[model samples]
Target: MIKPLSMIIFGQDAEQRSLTRMQLISGGKVNVVAESSDYAHGLDLVKRYNPDSALLITNGKSEASLDLAKQLAKEHPSTVIVCTGTNCLTETVIKFFRAGASEFLMQPPSQAEMKEVLEKIVAARATADQNKQGEAVIACYSYRGGSGSTTLSVNLAATLAHTFEKPTTIVDLNLQQGTAPIFLGVKPVYSIADVAHNQDRLDAQLLKSFHTPVSDNLYCLASPLKVEEADDVEPSHIELLLSLLRGQFAYVIVDCQHFIDATTVAALQQADTILLVTLLDMASIYTTKRTLEIFHKMGLGDDKVRIVVNRYVKDPDVPLDKVEQVFGHRIHLMLADDYRAALSALNLGSPLVSSQPKSPLVKQYIELAHKITGREATPKKGWKGGFSFFGK
Candidate 1:
């Protein structure tokens, strides 16, 4: 049995609103969660309830109805908009669609037509949920600075974009001091702050406009340009932005801030895989342990949170087995220590995957990307071993 669609009705005329609600609820195909004759109150109810559909009755005020439809489509993309009006002219229907209405029904809507629309919405939502399950959101996070989370995020995004040949975006969540744009060698005209500020009017097209194109398939949603702008961002905004991006991009990579905050927690919670990056030093290990405890408290387990050791060297003092024994969890991956190559790439303002493809560090990144995608890493020619698996 299909789940009944939740809907909200908005109309200036109380009589029309009541009639529409009655028809919608007759067959039990639609559940009228709220009904409002006032536009402001209707908008508030939609935000509060976040219903599956919004039914706008265009009685005397067509312009106002269209405006409401447009606003709802931009702010709540998941909610399907259906407009009913007396004037079902060609131009009138076109205007509704342009304003983001999915379906148009004449005044005194038929139960059959409304039922058809509800069925379509349910089927469409099912397909969208399946697609979302296939998409991946990978977040690179650390509790201490200089753990190289940003570098890992940028290079991994680049490799995923190149390997999959699909659209991939790396979001810089280190609002105050984000450098993902610098690492990618692009100066973005807009930042995540812009997205938050204009969230009321944000849609897929508007979001694409804000992205700074790094490559054919790679894009960057930069951090705030001014440090003060970071204050304007909220956890709710991060959640909304990521949800929208998930629908548009094949992969979303988030470079989270070093410290734990509400905003960072928001991103971590949304991620399908959280790469807990850290160094092999005792201090860094302790910080990572604390972070793991916090994550455990947050209901994130070892399955979602994978520890990655960056800038790793084969130090006898800090053996991999001992670190695993201490944490009671295995380290997921270890990136080789290559200060010269990393510094050179930074100077060139490019990821090592692109600046120095032959570097071993780049191969490890490729391997990591392949592992995330559940594919075997391709072996490089002239190398005795295919690819080193330090995690093994």
Candidate 2:
């Protein structure tokens, strides 16, 4: 089946706009959403129409055209961009490509060239949609509070997005006292209850509406604002909600409450990796051992259950070797204690990975992301300085 292509034309020349519109229409599969006279207006058109592709005219010495293309590509990576101009110089084509334009056409493009470009865009979109359908789900749980499971969940999701550049989401399943949203500094207008209420009519767009953006690539599905609201969420709702989210995001990190309930059980069953967070304390260790036994009875193996030691130090009340022997499972990940950094992030309503990018905590999360993604984590130049909190 032939897919329809939505396009917006950008050019100052009336004659050029007319020619391009005529050529696009002649292709019989393109729909012109809007026309712009300059790069600024073209950006406004893109924001309004959200077409499948934006056709930019880089005539003369319009360096601003390349800037606009780069901005659109970075901000809206899903949109395809094509550039056309009288200057088909190899240097000009290279610039357009670097600016994120997928295809370039000469002035008054032939019908064959237009058709070929549209087909390429459509085929690429189809393949991307197919590949992004299944997402990895990571669930973080602890038998005791203050084990830092929620903090791990939030930073792990952010690291997966910032480091791996994949679309990631964190779900707060601790309904009553969930702090995932607070950590991200987002007061969501809608919560998971809203999704449960509208489950019958839920779709990708509707599910996404409940997600509040934590960053360009990370989002959060916050817990219920009112504790009582969690009562309305059913275990089946959790299963369905995760299924829907898996289709939309590349990674879904779930922060579960301390106690295991119907909702948490459902989440654990769906998780690709169940992170059991503990501390170097007797209480935390004892609880973790019991939790692992429960997982065993539930038919989960060592591969599925990953033991994480949070707030670990070289010397502790309970030694690492002793803890491992007691649990009978090697710790898969260890996060160093940074009380000052953790306190600042909690107080500032931002994640440590974003707030204290230079903090060693951020590297721990990055390493965890690498472990989960099976990808290598490389440090950037001056990365030791860390990143500013989204320019905060």
Candidate 3:
């Protein structure tokens, strides 16, 4: 059985406050956590109890009632505020609701009316809890520049957005010379530099203005258009920008720069899962092993680091076991090598998953998305690439 809705009540009229408390307690669904005659004391009680609902009762004309309600709503969005007063005119009620009152009641509320109001608040809480979920930060990086990190980042983002139909944004953390926007064929007017500049006023709506929309669910916050603009974005700016984006987006895919600079380190620290993309070649493999050591030093656990072998082919030269032994972690995902198909998509300024939907390379990209999101994406019918049969 679910516990009762915890509540705090504040009223000027002691008789009215006592009556309301009696009604709420009788219902057996509302737990009166705290009660106060002073509005200021009530605010303190609210902070202490962290109740689900706050009942603010206005006796005659206490301006503090509305002020307290507004502050509570702003500070604790989870708490529902119900305003009840004798001067509850339609215009006054509208004003109270605008001040963040979930429900407004006349001075003398009957037992049934109080019960109904509490029921409504309880129901709304349940719905909100069901919808609330933590945002995912998928940061893709590579020790070597040519390991196809950006390719994997963009495609993984597109696949997550298209398959799950959730709001996704790709942050081009390759502040200088980042080509994530180029792969999507998007020219963003506002980039990460703008976010850094406007960090003081950065909110969901303001951040939305900086993104270049690719589709209904997918957006891109491109890198600085000018190389010098990248200098303006500091590690602190990257951390604040990503923290704001995480609240608004269901998935924030960070296309990280190859270098282990301050900005890149900031991204790695915030990521829910870091996709370490690498190729099977000697140079890429050796660099990745070194990178893993650095990750260990930084206290990044193996669970948070997912090694993705890009352009993978099961060649005898670099066996799978040897690669895992070097990295000290299993390869979480392997993307197939289809040079012609991949190059065509890159040239066309589109993600491979959308450009070549039926290709096996796209299928593997979808599977990689599944591995990250734990959601299976339906594979579309299409021509397998030339190397699909021979590819891993």
**Per-residue accuracy of model 3 over 180-227 as CA lDDT, tens digit each:** 877777667989999888865665677789999887688999999889
TM-scores for every predicted model:
0.68, 0.63, 0.67
State the C-alpha lDDT per candidate: 0.82, 0.80, 0.80
Off by over 4 Å in 3: 1-135, 379-392
Report the poorest 10 consecutive residues by lDDT, candidate 1. Answer: 383-392
Clashing pairs in 2: none
Candidate 2 residue-wise lDDT at 309: 87
Residue 83 CA displacement from its true place in model 2, Å: 46
Q: Model 2, range 242-326, lDDT digits (tens) per residue?
A: 7667667899999999998899988997687889999877777888899999988876778878998898888866677887899
* RMSD of every prediction: 9.4, 14.0, 11.8
Question: Residue by residue across 240-325, what tens digits does model 1's lDDT show?
Answer: 68766876788999999988899998888778789999998889988888888898888776787788899988999889999987
The prediction achieving the highest TM-score against the true structure is 1
Where does the lowest 10-residue lDDT sum fall in candidate 3?
383-392
Query: Of 1 and 3, which scores higher on TM-score?
Result: 1
Which residue pairs overlap in candidate 1's backbone?
none
| Candidate 1: regions farther than 4 A off | 1-134, 376-392
Best-to-worst ranking by TM-score: 1, 3, 2
